[model samples]
Target: MTTEEIEKVTERGPAASAGVTRRLGPATGRPSEASVLNVFSHGILVVWALMVGVPLLWVLWSAFKDSNGILTDPWGLPTVLHWENWSNAWNDANMGQYFVNTAIVVGGSVVGTMVLGSMAAYVLARFTFPGNRFIYYLFVAGMSFPVFMLVIPLFFVLRDFPGSSLLATYHGLILVYIAYSLPFTVFFMTAFFRTLPTSVAEAAMIDGASHTRTFFQVMVPMAKPGLISIGIFNFLGQWNQYLLPMVLNQQEDKYVLTQGLAMIALQQGYENDWGALMAGMMIAMLPVLIVYSIFQRQVQSGLTAGALK
Candidate 1:
């Protein structure tokens, strides 16, 4: 008999298909619990979205209002859209210079972190060598050291860094950021590297590919999801960095977004231009928002795939 006829016969027989199906869990019978959970999850998500969105929207709109209008009626909208707030924040407040400085620092550090961190992680995950675990543990150990603990020693280290003082230089700050960012990056990427299939890498090796070629051409492409996820994480952390630059980059001309914002706030003191401050914040936030939105899918997929491994 055909598959359909066999099924029909089985259903008609004393050995019933209904009984076999009935023996399965509640999931086979009904989705009431799943429905409830879905509704609950969606409700929580909506609440969380509002909690995040409301403040951001407030910041965006408040950037158009004058100081008095913002202070006197906090919830009210701007009577006239003040586009000059952005211009003033960018040029007059020196946020433009800070934005460029932040971009340069973050871009260099993120690229360095991803390259070095990925190499280290790939080796740790794939190769079996003497002191491999020891080296991996050493990198992992750096994560335990807090920024506060490092600040004092780092200050002296930068002050007397070999040939020259690395105290306030761009390269100095980039090096510091890379060093500080590596521990976590190495840890995360190592786990992700382990999750990737080794068969393709092995096949590449079998086909006369050198380790470097196989890694760069084969493994790296395969690990795109993980790399993109970790890259974004590193970028966000480096871009939003405040304390490191504040401590190391003391030059006013080399000040980053965070430092510039702090200076603006300090300079504002009593007579704060809330609108300009809001405009400055929006400028800083826009890039990060765009990045996350673009890579949201990759990030979700990467994290889940790593977790499954």
Candidate 2:
């Protein structure tokens, strides 16, 4: 071949290779489309992040501010961080007692719901009994029932007790919370249990494990995600519950954090301490945020895991 022909052929090979590389850019290297999408996606995500984060930032900043700072600059940085605001809120609001009361109601309700809901779900998922569909629908219907509608009846029933009503007692609030939380728990757990492969239950049965044993031993371990999700939901719901606590426990000693904050905010005769009120709100919200951060992945995974199959 001539020297010019050889040069031309060699150049063609590299040019062809470059063309192939362009086509395969997405798989082998970065592409323009991908870069654009990444930038756009991140921009959208940042906007959403700010939407959620700004309010939290405001609350946190308000906590550190004095009353003057709050009035003068609601959106501005605090001139000085009022560390004593936290201590003042804790002591003056009797927040310690509220925390204790909240723990009892939230803790007991979560425990009861998990135990009872799991048992009920296992039975509904595994055994084919009469009225199974009916029972499931009944639980589903409970989800639609208005909580406010039953408050009056619930109060009267509790009041009918011989001595003490469900008024301010922890156990009474727990029972009511359990009943209210049960429908969702049962619904979430049943779906989770149904998604699990039945072969495990069959194998356990072959190995001489009874239904209850199989459920507790084999099934319960697998259902931890669902349990955690349900527990977090119930815990948050009960912990932040205001209406029930306000109505059920009229006494200040039995107030939940939400109600206590209301009292602080509405300091009737005296001027409301906006800074301290904001500080209390931030404190109340911290636990929920912490819990969400801790179990968010599990809760998210569990919530969607059952829906596929």
Candidate 3:
């Protein structure tokens, strides 16, 4: 063979060998391991979805059935819609009143938490001061503290709150909710605030804007995603809170949705109004589901934005 042909063959020899090795690589178990991992992960996700979704769907459909129907065929779909179940839950079960109380308490608590938590987080993230790390670590420590342990002390504090007993009052519950939610809120917002650009805030300051003005106008708008995300989390938590309201608010008239639901469940042994109970459950859940659905994208972005930054 010519020298050119000999050289060409040598080049092709290694190339062909590498091509064969590539083709056989997958058969050596690497692809199977990856496929198995994918299948396992997907299976776990599907199971988790079912665990969460099935109960919710069951409650939804059962809300449209009568008590007898619900008890007899728990898994069956409603053949006829019992619209009165909703009205009954609203009126007879006092879910409307409970809902209003929840809205007031949760609304106020969320507003207060965002306002206060954001301010604290921004300061911690942007400013340098004595005890800054101490204060930040203190907030972080609060997250690890068991809430149930504080309930007794909180009870007394609110009870003898100088002016009057805060027990069974809207404002009182609002305050507790704010405190309970603050730790994580501060932690999350602090991290998010650090991820934000300091340059914009500096520019705002140079423009003769006050710290307050810069935060509300510039920093706040920039941190909108984090705010919405934390707000939703606070709403869900405070809305569903049973322990605090139960211990703090004993007045039946002042019961929140969680308390009212428990009341309804307790009455079930006597009244057997399973359908109304399910309907009320749906009532309490709908707001949470709706809020989450509306802000789903914002929540996802907020959670991931800091990590990306």
Candidate 4:
């Protein structure tokens, strides 16, 4: 071959060898790193799903079973649906009243947290002010402080709160939930607000909209995903909160669902009314599960919005 032909063959030799190597690479018995990792990750996810789903399914089916069945075959499916368990739990256990109280307290606190948190976040994100970073960091710091450490001090503060003792009252508990939830709400919203487009806000201002009107009418609508996300989070936290209410809400009649459930668990141990207890647990869990199911997409969008920007 000529010198040019030799040069061409030399180049083709490496290219042909690389093609052969690429084709043979997967034929070897060993799995690729990516496929192995993918299988491992999927296995982990499946295991995790089973871990979480099994108990929830157990609780759901148990709610329909009689007390005897629950004791006899905890893992087995319900043989006969006992619907009275729900009514018994609701009325006999005072779960109905507790459910109402929970709704009221959690509803009010969620609204309050969103309104206050969003406003604070909007200001911190959109404007420069004295102590802006200081205030923002202060909220961030609040998240790090353990709730257990504040329970005792919170008890006294609510008890001696000016005008009336906030202890054991619905509004009082609502206020505490708002405070407990604010730090994370504010922190989350502040980051989310920063990701929003400033042009829309500035345009609203140029259109002669006052700051208050601009925020409520213009900005809030745009931040709906974030609001829904944080609202659900706060609702879940405040709803399931045991310690704060346990300490602050001492009144039996005004007890929230968590307190009611604890009481039911204690009483059921002696009363042997396991069916009603299971039903009560379902009632408590239903609201949270329903809310999250409805807003799951919004929550995911809100969480990723900042990262996307």
Please give the RMSD of candidate 4 to the true structure: 11.1
Q: Report model 2's TM-score to 2 decimal places.
A: 0.80
Among residues 3 or more apart in sequence or in different chains, the pairs in candidate 2 whose N, CA or C atoms overlap within 3 Å are: none
- Per-model TM-score, in order, reads 0.81, 0.80, 0.82, 0.83
Residue-level lDDT tens digits of model 3 in 4-63? 579999999997787577667758677577668868998999999999999989999999
- Can you give the lDDT of residue 181 in candidate 4? 80
CA lDDT of each prediction against the hidden true structure = 0.86, 0.81, 0.88, 0.86
Error of 4 at 80 (Å): 1.8
Query: How displaced is residue 66 in candidate 1, in Å?
Result: 2.0
Cα deviation at 300, candidate 2, in Å, is: 4.4
Candidate 1 stretches greater than 4 Å from native? 1-49, 297-309
Angstrom error at residue 73, model 3: 1.8
For candidate 4, the 10 contiguous residues with the lowest summed lDDT are 300-309
Which residues of candidate 4, in runs, are more than 4 Å off?
Answer: 1-28, 31-47, 268-270, 299-309
Clashing pairs in 4: none
User: How much is the lDDT of residue 153 in candidate 2?
Assistant: 85
Q: Residue-pair clashes per candidate, as listed? A: 0, 0, 0, 0
Q: Which candidate number has the best lDDT?
A: 3
Residue-level lDDT of model 4, residues 19-47, one tens digit each, is: 56765776654445645786799899999
Model 1 weakest 10-residue run by lDDT: 300-309
